[model samples]
Target chain A: MKMLFKGTEAIAEAAIRAGCRLYFGYPITPQSELTEYMSRRLPEVNGTFLQAESEVATVNMMYGASCTGRRVMTSTSSPGFSLMMEGISYMAGAQLPAVFVNVVRGGPGLGDIQPAQSDYFQATKGGGHGDYRMIVLAPHTIQEAVDLMNLAFDLADKYRMLVTILADGMLGQMMEPVEFHEMRDLRDMPQKEWALTGASDHKPRKVTSFDIDPYELEKMNLRYQATYKKVEENEVRYEEINTKDADIIVAAYGTMARIVKTTIRMAKEEGIKVGLFRPITLWPFPYKRLNELADTVKNVLTVEMSYGQMLEDVKLGVNGKANTPFYGRSAGVVPTPTEVLEAIKKIMVGDLNGR
Target chain B: MVDKAVDKVIARMPKSLSGKEFTYCPGCHHGIVHRLIAEVIDELGIAGKTLLVAPVGCSVFAYEFFDLDGTVAAHGRAPAVATGMKRALPDRIVFTYQGDGDLASIGTAEIVHAANRGENITTIFINNAVYGMTGGQMAPTTLLGQKTTTTPYGRTVKANGYPIRMSEMLSTLEGSAYIERVMVTTPQNTIKAKRAIKKAFETQIKGLGFSMVEVLSTCPTNWGMTPIEASKWLEENMTKQFPLGVYVDKTKGGN
Candidate 1:
């Protein structure tokens, strides 16, 4: 049976079910519920939950736990997550596996505590220094958010890279029915041998991102790029609704996609052929699939809580094969289903991207 | 080969100290402190299970110098990292080696919180009064009226703040089990520094709480002084601002 669960709490429970026994977090809006849930739930399972002094501390703490070959995670909001950029880069450089959740909010510096996707670029791009890529998971529903927890941890471990759940205040605060899967018994899985348990009976080892030699560092970077190529090849996920005979397709992710789902139903009821293409992995981006889907549609309207951040990707994917128009609400504004439907109606009547 | 009576193995390079040659600048105390930590690890027979958290600076390559599992943390973030490691593996001995800028400045909140929580970990803080890796910028521990690259005309109280006494400041926290200020300028002080490091580790082994040893060090290259002059400068000027003594010792009930 499914039960009503808040998005933030469901995400927390899902991470716990995914064999994450260690968590370090600092409280922030929208996502504070997840931190609070972990603070209580972790102890019940005999897991470690440390409220770090700051996001910087939390990320390093997660890195430390990751070094031990233990599954660890942390959650924060936009401003707080910005402080973790350096640690994120370090984790990527060191090839450490850890999960980070950013329930994004308005940004560019202390943007209010409202939902926004302005961090789309920051999440998919290497927010920190260096040529590193983080596997970003964007979930449109509470159930999907919960379901992706396992994949998030597995991908991090599989790629030996950082995996982040890109959420926002809208989805973080919304409540919906969610059914949890069985908890994973980590004992049944293979342990990471490269973990920093100790050097007893073996040679000493180290896990570090620092290499003074530029040549050696370049080699490591090349290896990371290779791994990213493999990830791109293997981990592209997306959802297509009503695209079999649709004239217009809506592109979005996370909270905005959920809102677009409502718009999809409203549009279909009005006998308008509108489809939705929601990206699950925002970094790998499902660009190939999106391009294929865009080939079938006449126009693709990209919607977001930010001013067309993901629109850039949609435009590239469509490659002018379809009209790639954008509709978004910025600075804590929640674009309603009606607003999105109106935008779709405008697209049906005229090309919004007629540049 | 000499006869058994003709020679005695009074001392040798510590087994835990790896074969890596010292990379620190001349007159720097990091190499000696590294040996001290290795010697203590050897003494305790924990070279196999100790996890070292290296900080960002000249000693950022501490993982290469020690014969154990180790990792380098971002600047001033080592204490927090060690907290996670120790918490994750309760049986493992976790420690951080950090510099003044890393610990006393950028990482102040992390270190204080780690100490306040009584995290079962150890810290070896290197206070060289100047940011060694960043071209000798004035550190939080840089003495007032001391000239650094950033403070070209000698630090003034009106502009740059006075040297921060981290050991004294941290010892005041209730969760700290051990906190000491030591220097490695002289042989005697080096011995004392090693003793402090060992006691800090013992405190962790005893499951007491957070333990730290803040070692006053020299930066000859950055200080524009010869090795000998650097040692003298540390002894004469650094000690004046940061006293040498134990500030906290919960193992002995209190200090």
Candidate 2:
């Protein structure tokens, strides 16, 4: 059965279906509806929803919930996500599993509440301090958002690492048709042996991020590196659209990918052979696939809502094989399909060739 | 041969304690406070169900000494972490151990709001006059006219703000079910401190509300005083600034 839902509400309901019973978050724009939805729905399912005092506290609360070996999540926008960096780092260091949703807004400082993909670097790279990586999934539609929310919890638990849903404000606020999956049984999930359930059934456990001894810390870092390597090898995902026989290919993710899809359609009508490569998993970015596509495509156009953030990755993936051009709008500006198509045309016509 | 009569235990570590030596300095009150909490947990028979949220000050590694499921929280965020733990596992007993720097300064917002929300958790706050872990820096509880590394010439009211009486301040909040300031300066005072710790946990077990025991602890190493003198200094000076008493006890009114 198909149900229409805002991107924010879909993610919230998906989390419930995914057996995430504990949620801790502070109110932030573009994502407040997610929190508000959880507040009303969580209790009906006997789940806990706590609106924390601040983003700092909310993330720490997530850390606490995560330590109990429970599925937990929080959603916020850009500025609030910045406040959660420290807690995110702590969770990473402790090797706890939790999900974070970033309904990204404009950046640098207190940017407007409109949609922007400027947090690409902060999300794909470690937003917090230290050498750590989160599994970042970018969903273009509300339906994809629902499906990814279910997968996110499993991936977080599978790797014992943080997982992030990177969505733009437009995707968060937009309404679309979504199909909710069946509820997952909490008992069917894998047991967390390291969790601090209690001391009665087993030896006392201490979940901590502190390691004073340099050698011990190094060993922990090596373990994390090994885990991330496995994730990179096993979890890279992306969607390919008409790249099999195309002269120009656009590289985008999330909302930008959706717009690029329209750009491809428009370009096709004009006899412009343009395709798209949409990265579903943004962190272990579909670099290998893009490298292959770079071999075949004549040129690549990187589209975003920021000043060429993901373009860096595109350039790396293209690896001098194809001419890579960039187009973006910053500070809460959403690029329309015509504008994106024009940029593609510019790249295809060699109008932006040398520079 | 008469079997050597097993002297009914003269002294032994509490069952809740892991039997590990604490790393605190000789005169540090953290050892005393840890013992009191362990004893309370043991007596209440909740050691098996207790979860401790350790803080990032001197007691940052407190999980090592307690034989209970615990997690070491980030600096000054123990209350927030504990709030999450208790809320998630409502059947389990959760508590936080924090210091002056961790609780009164960086964690002020967490503690205040946790209290306001009346989270069903207990807090054991150790308020030394200075930041012991960072080497004698002034703390939010530092007494005026008291000299320390940060306040070399003496903490002056003109320059620095007056010491915060957290127990008194927290008592004003409606969500706080129990708030008391106790010290372990003497044997009698240690007993009173243990009693206060017990009552704090009892409040939580009863599902009352937020209960906290603010311990007026001594830091001999930081204060540049002998272990003996630190006790006297705490009793003479610290207690005057932070009066030793129960500011709020909701159970007293049978609430």
Candidate 3:
């Protein structure tokens, strides 16, 4: 039940267990292991695994599979993910249930293959040309990655929307103990009446993003907005560590969140009264919870691998109730727990030089 | 006068067609290609289990015309999309209807890789030598010395690359089971083109590897010619550049 596995491998296995029978992806660093694992294992399970020609094809493949209401997913790094933007927008516009795993690396233009949280905006915000939102789940540990991969399919099917598992190069390549969940059979899953299977017993169905008429397009956008509002209301997830009795809260997610946890413990040992606030669901962000935490904290220190991308969200969450400062390392430079602790200490001492 | 004998139904619209009028320009060969595919699907009794992947050109609204289940794919990504559809539901017959710009230009990688993988799907390629939907623009299949919006001075080999022979190129891949280049300019050629489409569909139905039928079509509006003149022009000039006939036929023997 428990085994040492790389985060990418664990996510692949978790996908298999979650009844994801179709895997379409292009190989990118840190996430190639996931695609390679699928290529080997999917056949054994009678599932479809295709190494697509490119990230563009990979996402369109997901779109096709998702049109059949089947559980499908694709994984890529930043540059590859960028290539998939158009397809992702199509999937979102069509309201297809699919999963995307971004083993994020440094970028602006193929910056580096090392881990970075530079894609926070691309993942949470609309990366492609559309007024659409995808459910984004950021996991800090390999085990959490496995768990979230299992849940992503269900949430995607539930909302009939795309779900993104936003991890980083470090989490994807690092090995950790992960307990596998129970295997699910695709046969037991509910059928999607809207799928484009065939016109055997019913009329044919069409999966498309084009509503040429402006009124129909606007109506579709409104429905999508309503669905996203519902997701924000019900699906916000996060974790609060030592925030109950702390003066300073560190807001982070994914790999940065793991480092922030360590910093929280180190600062607590030094009696700095610093805690961690990690957003598990980055899109349906835990803004309300962060607001509640801000009410008790003196200041919020946001840590990230990029140059303060998520800092804007943290500041918005704090809503002028608490002073928010940011400390970040850009272009694939990951900060150590000591460095984060020093940043937290600086914030506590009112010397917000990094801000 | 004796009552006229009841006229027999010489031909009727195939049930696979939804009776929706095509959105293609007048004299567009897409209408003919759509009818041929529908007839094939009907003849094979696969209409109930067929899925068409419509591409992003003039035939982008193909789903509206085909009664079968369908999905509209991004520009040049129909083959990739059809690959997924066929792989996921192997029992279903999948096909992609694409234009020259969509397949030969934007989606070159997808088509080549899908054919190389021997994915069990059919592709109906319409090579009009110019982009249709976005007005007249040079396509990858545009013949040398042909003029278009992008090639106002004519498509010269020095500035623009030579036209791609997709059928011949795809036939070179070992995975492709059947590959043919046919034109719909004349009634005789239309019949030949229909046979090629049916054969490509049959190749897929038999679970053969990649199959494709590239139909050399006419773009009257873009060509700045009347419908009749465009057809004659395609028969004259296009055929010389992109020859017709079966380039590869795995069932008949070899390429």
DockQ: which candidate is best?
A: 2
Evaluating just chain A, the predictions reach TM-scores of 0.96, 0.98, 0.97
lDDT of 2 by residue, B1-255 (tens): 223566465767899999888999999999999999999998999988999999988898799999999999998999899988888899999999999999899999999999999999999999997999889999989999899998999998888889988888888889999999999988998999999999999999998999999999989999989999999999888888999998989977668
**Of the pair 1 and 2, which is ahead by TM-score?**
2
**Residue B229 lDDT in candidate 2:** 97
**Docking quality class, candidate 3:** medium
Tell me the tens digit of each residue's lDDT in model 1 across B1-255.
444656667777899888788789878999999999999999999888899999998898888988889999999899888988998999999999999999999999999999999999999999999999989999999998888999999999999767899999998899999999999988988889999999999999999999999999999999999999999999998999999999989898643
Q: Give the TM-score of candidate 1.
A: 0.96
DockQ, all candidates in order? 0.85, 0.86, 0.79
Task: List the candidate 3 regions with Cα displacement exceeding 4 Å.
Answer: A350-355, B1-7, B253-255
Cα RMSD for candidates in order: 2.4, 2.1, 2.8
lDDT of 2: 0.92
The residue pairs in collision within model 1 are none
Least accurate 10 contiguous residues by lDDT in model 1 chain B: B1-10
Residue-pair clashes, model 2: 0
lDDT of 1 by residue, A1-355 (tens): 7989999999999999999989999999979999999999999998999888888889999889999999999989999989999999999999999999999998779889999999999989878999999999998888999999889999999999999999999889989999998888979654787889989956777888978999999999999999999999999999888887886889989989989888888887887878889899999988888888877878899999999888998888888888888899988888999999998988787533452
